[model samples]
Each structure stands twice: as structure tokens, then as C-alpha cells.
Target: MYAGNSFEDEIAGLEEEGLRRKLAALPGAGGKLTIDGSEVLNFSSNDYLNLANDPRLKDSAKAAVERYGCGATASRLMAGDLILHEELDMRLAGLVHQQAALVFPSGFQANLGAITTLAAKDGIIFSDELNHASIVDGCRLARAQVHIFRHCDLDHLEGLLQTHQRGGRKIIVSDGVFSMDGDLAPVSALRQLADRHGAYLLIDEAHALGVFGRGAGLCAELGVKPDVVVANMTKALGSGGGFVAGSRDFIDLLINKARSFIFSTGLAPACLGSALKAVEIVEAEPELGAELLRRAKFLRGLLNEKGFDIPDEASQIVPMVIGSNEAAVEMSGALLERGVLITAVRPPSVPDGTARLRLSITLAHDEGDLHRATEVMAAIALEAGVL
Candidate 1:
């Protein structure tokens, strides 16, 4: 038998620190879910708009599969460029008010492609300290000079920009809505900083798309256009893929130079078609977006009333910081026992000593769900000394 002592020791360390992650099967859709053979009210998903189970998207996916086989068969550079993919690109570009867009297999790949392709070896990248892992890895892959600024601190970002202004191409990157914190980025401020420094700004809208700016994104809502926009169709769009939208030249460059886009198989046709239908729904039904925001606000208010120390953000993602990792894990278990499914986010996903439960609100959750979840969470948190 093969023995891996180092791997086992590392896993043991993780378990001792309450940072070990185990995958639980989620058999049902968002909102209501079945996990580990138990039904629970799921507040751990990223389906902010609750379109993951929509009949229209299902129908669109079925039709696309029938029309254009199941798989892309090859990369876009070869045989994977389906008409549905082109349609998604066009629609996404229009949504973000960009001149063009390119789809990738995932949001991770999209960020990797956009950042690594745009920021070359000699380029300088200014990234938010709390930016997603994808952006962090992308910067590393680019082999560029990366300066991480304090999260949402424009002054620190400007200082870094000024310090690095004398060199090669500069790229400023951030997430529109921080996935864990659920806080909005300073898009307008970042835009101004980019303009002042003559740098390119790339905003990842994975959590902001379909939930902000009438489903366009945070940049659109703030009335500021970045040099490039990256978004995931899997979250609010209820589809599976990511896309980068920007100037025609920029997108063409990515097509030619982005290894992630060129080497990886193209996005499946079903995902493209379903996302297309999702875009149409978002465009036609403004109420969906409005309702999402309302529900998020309501959930935040409930958490606040219970003294959970939730952030006063407008986004659908809410985090309850339970400083101790062990406490956070125990609280998550208690909540699960109470029929609520909120995952404990610990180190690596979050900063050390800042373990928390990341709560995601969805349009599918009614007022009743919100009330029950908050009540259960509050009781558990109080018992565990987390509130």
C-alpha cells in the first residue's frame, strides 16, 4: 500500500485547526436542498436570483442540446465555437456595455485568461488584497509585478499606482462584489484611479452580475466603465460558464493569446443557451433583480436585529464573523441540526481568526424562510457564544 505520511499529517493539522473541508452532496437545487440524506433550507449557495431551477432555463438547455450535440467536441480555436457561444458573447457584451466579450469554461478560467493575457511579464498589476483566488492565481501566472492594496482602500491603491506608474502596462483588478464579505467595491473610485494612472481596470462581476444594475453589473450601476469586465454565468445567470467583456481589440487579443481560452474545450452549448435565456429573463423582468435586493436587505436586517454583527452591505451575500474556527464549525453543526444549511468558512477561504458562516440570500427564499433561518441561526450563535 502507498503511504503518504506528509499528506496525512497535513490533513490532521487541518482537522485540528478546524480548517479541514469535506464535501457534502447537495442533491437538490438552491433555496431548498437535500444534503447527506437530510432536507434543509440552504443558505450556502451563490444562486442569488434563484434562477438555477427555472423552467425556462431548463427548456432552453434541452433545446440547445437537441440542436447542437452535448459537448463542444473541441476548443474554440478548433471546433468548439458554436453559434450559441457567439450569441452569449454578444448578449454579455451588451449587458456590460462593452464592445465585445469572450466565453470561457468557468469564471476561474475567464479570470485566468483575462489577467494573464493582458498583464505580461513586464506588466504591473494592482490587485485588492481580498480579490478572489482566481485573480490572485492569474497575477502569479502572468509573472507580473503585483502590488496588493488594502481592500477597498482607494488611498492605498492610489499610492501603489503612483509608486508603480513609471513602468510597463498597469492593470488594476478587483471583484465588483466581494464574494465572502458581500460588500461592493469602489468601482467609480477604481475607474478614476485607472484613468489617472493610465492603467487598465478589470472588474470581476461574478457575484455582482444579474443582481446589480438591472442585471448588467456594479460598474453599470455606478456609471463607470472599466477597461475589462469578467463575470460568471453560473451564479445569478443559473448557467455554467464565465465570460470576459471588453473592447473588440482586447477580446480578439484574448482569443489569440489566452492559453486558458485556447487550450480548454469551449463552453458547452447547453450552458450557453440557458445563459442566453437567463439574460432575456433578467432584461424583461426587472422585478427579479429588485426582489433579490429586497430579500437580501431583509435578511441583513434580521441578522442585525439578532446582533450577529453582519455587515451593512446591500448585496445578497452576508457573513457572520465568528472569530474562532472551532466555534464557527460548531455553530454550523448546530444550525444544521436546526434544519438550516450554512457552511463554516475558515482559513484559506477567509483570513485566520476570522472564520464565519457565509450566508447567501436568494429570491426563492420567502419571508418565512428568512424568519426561520434567522431565528435558528441566532439561537445557535448565542448558544455557541458567536453572536
Candidate 2:
């Protein structure tokens, strides 16, 4: 019999590659996780607004937990429908200018449910190649004849639309904000494409919410109307849930058909109430949005001034592409040692040979922190031979 060592040795050979090999050695990430000996600055988390630590949101969660208990005893369809959930959903709909809204356990499940249940049979989905994993998975689950369009490539999208316009049910879907590249989708063009092709449009506003659209999403920011808009409260809302906003009929269709929602337990009162409060904060304190953009611009500029090739964008995500996974991991580790935390994103999060540092900026970080982090990054990059 062959030894298990054979398979182990094969896995060990992954280091010879530049992508997955580096993540294998990544320093600890996440707020609760540590990479290397020091607790790295959290640049990888989706917590964009630092609202996770906001006193108001925390207090809301505490109050709800005290009032409603820790968890829902049953699925929403079976009795988990808390009043707080309805309030949050309605508020999100108002924020996004949608006729109705429905919440889900996570943004991931929201996409899964919305796309799959709504477009399952005889449907064709046109998706951006650079969309988030959840969107890609959702499209897969939809069992649609998924058509891939190049990242933000409106030209390619049009070509696909012309080629498959005969679809019984068709939808064009994309991320409102590309999480890794920190770039905006060509939503305006896509809207035009959807119109031209007679296809419904779905925009996942997970990252865009709270950061763009004055806390709603890019759809509101760009003044574009999609057939559906899905978002997560976890990232910027600092809560743990997702929502899909659309026409009352579309939302109703999802409520009855979305397996992710129908089968899973609903968002607990603690998370729902906290999310409701977070939306209120965004509604009232519009300045937080400007501050977020300002800080992101400032940070990207500092990185560029130090010779790092970061693009100028208002999005919270900033990627510093390093050629090899090994180099990317090393850059993050060295930065951590100097007290600047960054996430080394390697394949399959990114394509092979596109190992990069995914820096997620937040309003919580000040200019001083940016300067200190930039200096550390530059010094570490030079030492690691990556600059």
C-alpha cells in the first residue's frame, strides 16, 4: 500500500508555486487572529467603518441581547421573525430607494438565495469576472447558463448580451465595488447593457454600503437603478447580516423562494437591532462617509509617495500587487514586525502570480496611523526586496 506520506509530500510541493504557497505561510490575520509574534494591524477584515467597535452599535447589541436572548430558537419561517429584523429591512430599503427589502443570515447567503431562487430555471446570468466569491457561487447555484464578462469590461458584456439575448430569463450581476482592486464596477454601462439586452440587473452592494452612496451603496451614489441590490451590514454597518432590496414583488418572490432565508435561522435580535442602529448612524452622520474617503485617499497617496503602486481611489480597499506569493507573505510579515498590519492575499483569492497586499482602510485609522503604517510598509518592502 502507498504511504500517506506520498500525499503529504505532494501537498508540500505547493510552495514551489507563487500563489497558494505564500498563503500557506501567511502571518495571522483577522482581529482575533495573530500572524507572526505581533498582533498585526487588521487590513483584511470586511469591517470597513470600524463600526464593530462603535459604542452605539455595541450598546444596541448589548441591549438587544439583554432583551431578546442570545439566539433565535427557530428559523425565521418557523418563528424567528423578530420585529427588529423588519425594522432593519425597511430602513435598508429606504436607504437604497428600493420598494422592499429582506434580511439574511450573511451577505453570502443573501446572494445565494436572491440569485439562485429568483433565476433558477431557463435563466442565463451574465456576471463580471472579477466579482466576489459569494456572487460567483450564487451564480453557480442559480444553475443559469452563466456568461462571464471581463472585469468591468462593458464591451465584453455587450458582446455576451448580443450573443445570448434569446434567454427566457436573463440577469446581469456584478459587485458594486470590487473588493480586491478597490475599483467601481461600470454600473452605468451595465445598466445600459441590461436595458439594451432586456435583462434584469443585480448589484451586490456589500462593500459599497456605508462607504459609498452616503451609506446606502454605489447604486444610490451613481443614481443607477438595478433590478436588485444586495448588501451586508457586517462590513460597514458593523453588524452581522445581509439584505436584498428591490421591488415589493421581487422581495416577496425571494421571501417565498430563497432557500437560504427560508431554511436558515433568521438574524438574531442582537444583530438586527445593532444593524438598525448602524443604519441610523449612517443616515445622520453623513460626515463619516467623507472622512472615510479622505482617509483612504490619504493612505493611498502615502503609499504611492513611498513608491508603492497603489491606485488613487475612494474605496476602502487598496491592493499592492507583489509577483510571488512568497514575496507577498514576506511583505505582510515584515510589515507586521514593524507594527503595520496588512493582509497578504494570494491565490485563489487572486489569480496565480498576482499575490498582493489587500489593505482595507477605515475611518478609525487616523493620518498619523497612516504615516506610521506607510513608513513601516516601505521599510519592510525594501528589506524584503519587494519595493
Candidate 3:
């Protein structure tokens, strides 16, 4: 029904603006990987604890497959609610200090379900501007009056909340740690505002889990509890699923009204097995998150000393904001050529004119690895005129 090459023309426009994307087939895992038959220090992964390939997680998954089989075979409401699912739900809730939890097929689905169910028609939602795309999309689908406050600006949020005094159900949502900038949210302040406004608070800890608060996330670190806590096992948990933790009543409401969860198949058995093991590891060794933070600080200091103007954030994600998409991509390519791999993050993932290279540190890297990576990164950045 459309003219030929319409998609091609759109893609060509993206290419011209340096926004084109392609999948790179990087082999292996962890902090060091083989790309194009050469070994490179990997700085683009979310495996903060390097547990994705751990033998314990793998063995747990294998044993689960043998015992419970591979698939859930139906939605949780149907015949798919296994004992493993219930166990993960309980353990994850305990980890976040919540009374109950519900698992979804993915983190995106969790957000979609929680947000839409919490704030329905005639409701009001106050959300952070820099929240992840999943949260953004959830807000869109909520059918509520959505107000986006300035990123991490509590005053702005309060102003918006004050203006919307006659709300049906008011909810405030934000990311625990912003994915691109790696800055932590002011969870305590946000919680205070929510309490003052009589609003339910939701925090997505997708980036902070297993890397902060001894694996419980930013809310736990700040001693601020929200109405809902959202996170995923795919990242630091080294598995594949997302969950929402809250009071037992709220979780029961989600089970009844969250369309995404009600319709989707239950999470696979392998993911549950591996994630259960990952959670246990974090619980046993709470220092893993602290050690990762220490490494992040070390890396940030090294880059700063080398004349790079990365933010002095405590999180493992380090972003070098380049003004142009072309320049950001060029810097990423240059770094790869020099045996270090940091992905170029461009517009839509970040704001326009703020394209960047996001460097994620993992436990697989050490002081020596960070130092070597810093040297290579500095050389490439200098060549690209970013230093």
C-alpha cells in the first residue's frame, strides 16, 4: 500500500544524521570479549557483578531444567504458576523489603503493568523527565493526566503536584539510577514529596539492583520505602525477568488488573532458577555491590585525571557526553579500534545534542584493567577532540 523504498528512505535519513544502528556480534561475555578476532576490554555490558556466566547460576539453571522442565506452558493465572515463581516472588520482595512481589516476563512489561494499573483514567501521574523508555511508555498507556517534572528536581515536582490538587489517584514515578547519566535519584526527597502530596510512589531499580544497597537497590540504601519497587533480573541478577514489589494488597490488585501480566506467559523455569541463585549470592555477600561502587569510583577518578569531563557519580555507569551524534559515534569507533569497547549512545536514548559513550564497569574488571582502559580511552578521546 506504500511506495517502494519508503522504509529505505527513512533509514537513509537516519544514516545521514548518524542515528543509524546495527547489531554487533561480539563474542564471549564479561569484562573482556573477542570482537572481530581480537580481544578487547568490554565496557558496555550491564553485568556489574560478572555473574552472568557464573558456574553457580548455570548449574542452578541446568538443574531446574532437568527437574521442572524448560517452559511455564501458560500464563501465571492459568497453569504456569510454578513453585519456583512463587519462591522468586517471595525472595525478591524480601530483598527489597516489600511485603509481596509479582513477576513478569520482562522489566518493560512490569513497568507497563504497574503504572497502568496504579493510575487509571481520571488519575494523575507525576514522572521524571529522564526515566527509562519503559516508564515513559507506561505513562503513555496509563490514560491518566501525566506531568513530567524536570529530572531530579524535587521543587519542580512539588510545584506540579500542588497545581494538580484535585486528583483521583496520584502517583509519582522515577528511575532509581538514570541509565544514561548514571546519577542516582534523590529517593529520600522524592519519598518526602510523595508523602506530602498523598501520592503513591514507584521507583524502578533496574539499573541499581545488584550494584547498590548490597543488592537491595537505592531505596534500601537511602532507607526510603516507596509504594512500589520495580526491577529486573536480566542485568546484574544475571537472569531474565522483571518483578514488582509492594504490599500484599497492591500485588493482589496487580494480579487482578495488570493486563500485561494477566495475558503474558509465565517466565521460563531456567530464568527463575538462575535468578534465585543470583539473589542468594547477593544476600550471602552483600559486599559485592560496595566493591563494584569502589571500582566505579576508581575508574571515574582515572578518567577525570586524564582530562575527560565525565560526571563524578558513584554509580558504575560513566557517560562522556559528546555534543554531536557523529562525534560520539566516531569516539566509540576509535575506542574500539584501540581495543576498548564502549557503546555510543545517541539521540532518543539521550537528548538531542547530548550523544555520549556509556561506560559500564563490571567486577570482571580490576584496577589494572581500568587503568589500561583509561589510557586507551584518553588517547582515542584526544584524537577525536573530545579531551
Candidate 4:
């Protein structure tokens, strides 16, 4: 279908642009992935609470496997609707104060389902400019006129909403927390605009579940309830999969109309079991949420003191603007050299020349870990002249 020396040609094309993506397998990229016996402090990964390897969560998954077996051989519309899936869905819905919830295979699927199912042929979808990749794709796939307002720009959003208030269904979508920038969306303002325009509000809270809202989301944390919400169990839940929570009628409609959910195999029982346990853990140990925030704050303060220009938001995602993908990658490599792991977020994942060293905090990391990581990053930036 395509011509080139395959891998080599692909690399050749990306080489000049400083973006050669190769699949180099690692033994284990769990809570902390290793390289050449050098432990990079894990600032990369969606396991926001480090629950990926949590013993309790793992045990629950094992128990579920013993009870329910390994794979889901059929789609939900067929023979794959396990009881565990329903239970997890119900509990997740309860967690977010939604009337109902449906479990999808991933956060991406949830976004795809929600955006595609709700908006109709005659609707106008008003979305945030800096929404997640899934939301962006979902908007593209959705059969509606998509109007992207500036990132969290309520004024611009209002302007668009006012212009489109004449007819047709209207919907607004945003992320509870912007993944790359680590900044929160203005959900409160967005909700007001939705109310004024009689539009529905949808939020993808993939990065804001456990660490935010006392274990809920920005909507709950800020006391702003959205009409629809989608989240991932992979990040803070420390499990795998995604979910959509909202009114029972809305969820019921998705169960019927969302092709991604209806045509896909149900979430495995182990994942469902683990997600249930993860939700339980969030409820039982609110201190874990507090600790994660504490660590995030500590890292943010430390990086700021080092003169790294970070945004003034309280989120686990802390980013340092390195200006070049090469510098960003080099900084990540340097941190690894010092026994700390950080990821370089470059173009496609982010805008070009805005490459950043993204550091995500979790309860698993302590002050010593934060201090060590900060010193390592600062040292690397100085050595690389990025400081």
C-alpha cells in the first residue's frame, strides 16, 4: 500500500524533523519502568495515583478472574455482558452522582461514543480548542458543525454560542483538565453558557478523577454539575477502560446508538473488578487523594523556584517549556541518567517548538522523590543550556 524502506524510511523522514518514533520494547513499564538499570523517576504515565500495581486492586482483579475467567469472547450485544461490568458501571455512576453509566473499552471510546451519539445531523457542536485527542477525533467523526473556541475562553465560547442560538441542537464539550497544559477548563463558566444557550455540556474527565473533586472531578470539586461526563479508569482508577456517566435516558440512548460501545466486546471482568476496587479505594482513602495533591503542589513549587515557568494551577501534570523536541527529549534522557524518568511531550502530542518535559505526580511519590527529581531536571536543563 505504502512505499519506503519501511522502518528505516520512516525514521529517515522523521530524522530531519527531530521526531523519529520507534518501538523499543521494555521489560516492564509498570509503576516505574527501568532502562539500563537506571530508574527514571516516573513523571510519565496516566496512572495518576500509582494504582496500576496496587496490591489490593490486583488482588481484586485476580479474584474476578477466578470467578469470571480471562477474556470477553463476545460483544456486549451478544454474550459479553458480564455482571461485573454492570456493577462497575453502577458504582462509577454513583461516584460521579450520575443517574447511569456505561463502561467502554477505553477513555477514547467513551469520547467517541458520547460525541458521535448525542450530536445529530442538524446540531452544532461547540468544543474547546485544547480538548483531548479522543474528543478532537470524536468531534471530527461526529456529524455536526464543530466550532472550536479558544482554550477555556468563555467569552469566545459565548460569542460562538450567541451566533448559533437560532435553531438545531447545540452541545459544548471540554476536558475537566487539559492533558498537556495541565490546566483546568472553566467548567463553571461553560455551564453558565450552556444554560444560557440551552445547550448540553459534556466533559471528559480522564485526568481529573481521583486527584480532583475529593475523588470526583472538576464539576464536583467546583460544585458545577455537567449534563454529561466521560472518564477513564486507567488513570486515577489504576485500572483499564473508560466510562460515560449522565442521565439514565442519555446512557440508555448511548447503549442503543453508540457504535463504539454496542459493537465492541465488553470490558473484561478483571478490569471491571479492578476499577470497582479502585473506586472503593478512592472513597475509603481520601487521604491518598490529598497526598497526591500535596506532592503535585510540592513539585510545582520546587520547579517554580528553579525558574521553570509553570502555570498557576493545582494539578498533577506539571510541564516545563523546553522550546524544542530535541531539548525536551534530552532533558528526559538526562533525568533518566540521574535515576529519574520524565517524558518529553512534543508535536502531535503538543504544538511544535512548544516541547515540554511533562511531570505527572502521584501519591506514590514523596517529598524526597520530588526534591530529587527537581534537582535532576534543573541540573539537566543547566547542562543542556535550556535553563
Candidate 5:
């Protein structure tokens, strides 16, 4: 029996650096959560539309279970692809205004497949500096040369494209909405740049789907069609899976060449059913996203009024930088003790010296909830000498 003493040292090192992570066994989802039997205002969740616990989504999941049973049983190519999977594929394509879509087990896998398949060995990938970890990993997995441009800096990206100009494939990838900063990408400008450089544009709408473009995503909202759109069902859609939408030919290429999708099991039927229903609801009530943004603005205003340095981004995610790892952890714990759940985000989730409280505004949080949480946060900051 080998006791890994090296792992023990690594664990101790994490704790000393205030980077150790532990799981909290919360009973359910949504804006209000019970942490150890005490109800708290949950601002740490990513369910921006509050659909995770919605009755309609639950019923859809139940129906899917009764119809298709539990697991996928095998890889999609090995007979696990069901009718529900096909329906979800079409639904997601329509939702993002693409010619086709291919579903994956998760958003991470979707990115791993899309980027690797699109950028060949001779190609180059110019990605945003602050893109999601999944995209970063995808770029690494691909054999293509990857050059990272400054975040949302079009001039830097154009310079990279020009410097690395080649006849082989060129792909520019970015997040429609940065998860940590909660800022939108310049989608329209990126589209123009891709056209000018004869490159393919890929935008991950993981944070913007079901909350932007009347649920069609940020690209659709801006009428800027990228060569490929990568997104997830877990966030605002209130389900579990991922999908990549693009032209029919591009999807076919992914089907043939993407190792992640080729080797992985098909998305589960329950997730497919629930995600389909979530898309339907979003289509029927486009205002749901608008109203959620409105609430976010109201809450941001409240936090700003309390003297917290909240950015003026329109996305539901609002971050409050607390500087040091220990102080951020202390602030999060203080908020939790005061019945507000805002988990602290530290490196490498964020950069060093930028530890923050990542507040995700969901539809479940009302005006009263926002007011009370900010009041509590401001008081805690003052006590900690942060205000």
C-alpha cells in the first residue's frame, strides 16, 4: 500500500495559500438555499433564469426518464443515440440560429471537441486571454498553434492574425460573456475580423444562453453569426449537457473528427428532455431574460450605492474584488454567517491579488433579497475594514 506523502504536502500547501476547496452539501438549487438548516440568500448559483427547480423542467425530466430510462447505455455511435437526442440537437440549433447542432455530455467536452476538430494541425488559434477554462483546454488539446490576445482587445487580435497569417485554417475563439468579469465580447467586430482574415470565428455562449438574444445567445442578439457557437445546458437552461451549433458541414466534420464526441457517451435523455423544455419556455417568454437583466441592474445599483466596487456590466454575474486570498475567504465566511451565500473565488479561477466574491444574479432573487444582501455585505465589509 503506497501512502502518497507528496499529495499530503500539496494539500497542506493549498491550505496555507488559502486555495483549498471543499464541497458544501446543499440540499437543493435556486436563489434561496438551506446551508446547514439555515436558509440563506444564495448568490453563488449559475441558474440565472431560476429554471433548475421549475416544475415544468422537473416534469419534462420525469417524462424522459419514463420513456428512455436512465443512462445512455453506450456511446452515441454505439446505439445510445435516442430520438430525444435528435430532438435536442435540432432544438439547440434553432435556439442559436445555426444550421445544425451536436450535443455532448457537458459543455467542457463540447469545447474540447469543437476547437480540436475545427483547427487542424497546420492551423492557428487566436483566443481571448480571459476565455473560459474549457476553451483554454481545447486550444491546448488541438495540434494548432494557439496565440492568446488581450481580453476584448480587437487590435491585439488583428495583429496576431496578421503576424500568423497562413493558408491553413485560422480560428478566433472567445467567450460571448466572460464568466468572471461578466463583460460581453465584441461579437460583431470579431465576425468582421474573421471575414477579413478568412478565419473561422467560434464564440462560447455558455454564460449568455437563455439570458441574451431572447434565448438565442449573444451572437443572435447582435445578429453576428460566428462560424461556430459553443454553449451549455447547465446554466440558464437548467439542465446538464453541452452542444455546438454551426453550419451543417461543420457539424458533420465534428461528428467525424471530434474525438471527445466520438468516444464519449451520448447526452442522457432526461437532460435532453428538460433542456428542450427550457428552450421552449425561453422562446415563449423572451422577456424572462430581459427581466433577469433588469433585476441584475437593480442589484448592481444597490451594491454600488453601498460603496461596493461593482462593475457596470449588464450580465447577471457581478464580481466584488476583495484583493487577498485570506480577506476574500474571510469576507465569504462572514457573509455566510450572516445568512448570505457568496462563495469566494481565488486563483487560479481568477488572477493573483484579485480574489473576489462572484455574485450570480438569478431570477429567484427579488428586490427584497437584493436590498437585504447588499445591506449585509456592506456591513460585513465595514466590519472587516473593506469599506
Candidate 6:
């Protein structure tokens, strides 16, 4: 409870190691943003469909506020469960082709709730090594026997499952699209393993919702239904909340047992309303998802032609794997100076010596924007010997 400059010293150490973080004042929206008082072409956002400032969503939010006021004054279990919340839950379940769904205040809380509730003590949770921090923490909170398989290594996962088959309530968890590496998990293969090993599978589709599978997600795109699916409305839906979808019984269990859900206040009306409209838009306009994938492929091709270390993928997320923390920070600063807003992802967000720039593409980015961004990034990468 008592410390003398220890917190300051730790922060200074983080600064020295290029691990310190600071918030930038970003005032505007979409691909072009007003960051630090300058108009920059932003590639750092997770708004895959560029719907954050969508007029339709704004109108829906406005209507919701007029009807339901601002905040959810109590928890969902108490007095905060509005009719809109029930409608949203039903619509979300329909979106994922699940029997039921439950909403949380944020994606992190959703993961924490789902994982901790499903895989409790006396369970074995097989997690991907590069799963999101929320999933990592969820596994820890579950207090289960956790086994981490190599990222996307189906054979390794199978081996671990085979060895741990005779266990109590086995669970396999992975990200539909890894946040940092910008690579997709092998959902089909994982599903097969789960089926064979009598284990339940959970896929966190935080980064894959609006940009994949006709706006359903990676699991839907691949025709592999997981036992549990968690997603964030903030990223693809351009709203603020998270959801868990699965069988009716599973969702009911979570509603009863998940402390994060039962204890926290319900999602605000504005977010629920905006997200409802966003889901409708995503489902009604399938072309938006296709266009997002096309842009991602185009960007990957452009960066690859320039000899940057980007993976060949069709998802809207692209990673430029820069090896050093200092180099990543320097490159991020240089890009900002050049009127581009790409973030430098360093250690803890990524593994050691695998720092990167997590470039994200959205429906708002056009051919010209992609060309200009790639040119600037290629030049900087070449100068820094990162290409």
C-alpha cells in the first residue's frame, strides 16, 4: 500500500524498453482522422466496415437515447433489461446462427465471463499461444488446467488433446482472427479435433465479424460451428459491447453463473440501438464484407510487391512484422510525420523480437489511399532495412 516513486520508476523502465503507452487525442472518424490536431490517413483502427460515424447508426443511437435515456441504471439481472436488450440478444443469436446470445458491456468482459463460466476448476482448457489478452486472462480466471498449443498448429493441438483426453470438461479456445498476427485460425480443423476429443470449442470472433463470411464470421465462413462464440460489437459493429452466442442451455448457464455479466451493468441503450442497426446493415449488404476482403488482399499484394514482411491473406488486418521495439516505435513516428497513422505494436502486445505495425483496412479506404499508404510505408521500411 506504500511506495516511493516505484510506480514512476517502473513506468520509466517501460519507456526505456519501448513498452510505455500514451493516449493520442483522435478527434474525427473513419479512415481519415484528426489525430493530434493533424489530419492523417488512419490505418490503426479496428472499425473494419468504417461504420463508426455511419449516419444510419448515428440516427439509430439518437432514437434510442430519446426512447431509453442514456445509461443502464442497473444490472441486467436487476432493473436494466430493456426490451431493446432482448431484441438485440435475439438478433445477435440469429446473426451467428446460434440458439441464444447474451450481451456484455465489452468484449473483454464477454470473454472473461464465457471462459471462466465454461471451463471452471477440474477442467482442461487448450488455448492458442497467441490468443488475445482477454482470453489469456479468462483462462487464468477459469482456474483450469491450461495447455497452450502452438499457433494454428493443428497437429500439436491434436497431440495435446489426445494426451489430455481423459479429463474433466475439456475446452479448446482460439481467436477467429488473431489480433496481432492478422492471421486466421484453422477453425475447421479445430472443430474436428474438438469433436474427436469430446471437448467444447470456443472461438473469439472479435476481429472477424463484419469482414468475414458474408458478415457472419470465420466460423460461419468455414461452416464450422463452435460450442461457444464471443464477439465485440465495437470493432465490426462500430458500436460498444460484446456478445456470447451458443446453445440456449449454455447461454442460460452463463446468464446465471457468469459474474462479469450478472454483476456488471447492462449495455447502454445507444450502443444496443446502434449495434442493432449495424448488424442489420452487415447482413443486408453482403458486398461490404466482400469489398473489405478485397481491399485487404489488395493492400497485402501492394506491401508484398514492395518486399515488406506481410502475410498473404484476405482479411482486413495486415501486420508488418518489424523485429525490434525501438525500430517499430521509430517507424510509427516517421509514418505519423508523413501524415499516416499506423500503430507500432511492440512486445506484450506481440511476442519478443516480433514487433509489428498492425495495419487494418476498412470499407472507407479506396485504391488511391492504399497506393499512397503502401508507397510511404515501403519507403520508410526500406530506409530502416525492415523490408
Q: Per-candidate TM vs. native?
A: 0.97, 0.92, 0.98, 0.95, 0.98, 0.97
Between prediction 1 and prediction 5, the one with superior TM-score is 5
- Candidate 1 root-mean-square deviation in Å: 1.6
Candidate 1 at residue 103, lDDT? 92
lDDT of 3 by residue, 1-387 (tens): 367569888899999999999898767877788777888889998888899999999999998899889999999999999999999999999999999999999999999999999997778999999999999999999889999999999999999999997868999999999999999999999999999989999999999998888889999998999999999998899899999999999999999999999999999999999999999999999999999999999999999999888788889999889889999888888888888989899989999999999999999899999999999988988888778
Superior by lDDT: candidate 1 or candidate 5: 5
Clashing residue pairs in candidate 2 are: 27-35, 28-34, 28-35, 41-341
Model 2 lDDT tens row, 27-107? 432333355555456677767777877789889999888888988767887988887778888999998889999999999
For model 4, residues 250-294, the per-residue Cα lDDT tens digits are 999998989889999888889988999999999887667667877
Residue 276 in candidate 4, Cα distance off native in Å: 0.9
The positional error of residue 151 in candidate 2, measured at the CA in angstroms, is 0.9
Tens digits of per-residue lDDT for model 5, 1-387:
346667878799999999998897778887898767888999988999999999999999999999999988888889998999989999999999999999999999999999999996777999999899999999999978999999999999999999998747999999999999899999999999999999999999999999999988899889999999999999999899999999999999998999999899898888988998999999999888889999999989998898888889989999999999999999999999999999999999888999999999999999999999999999999998989
Q: Tell how far residue 348 is off in model 2, in angstroms.
A: 1.1
TM-score of 6: 0.97
Report the error of model 5 at residue 359, Å: 0.5
Per candidate, the number of residue pairs that clash is 0, 4, 0, 4, 0, 0
Can you give the lDDT of residue 231 in candidate 6?
A: 97
The runs of at least 3 residues in candidate 3 whose Cα sits more than 4 Å from the true structure, single-residue gaps closed, are none
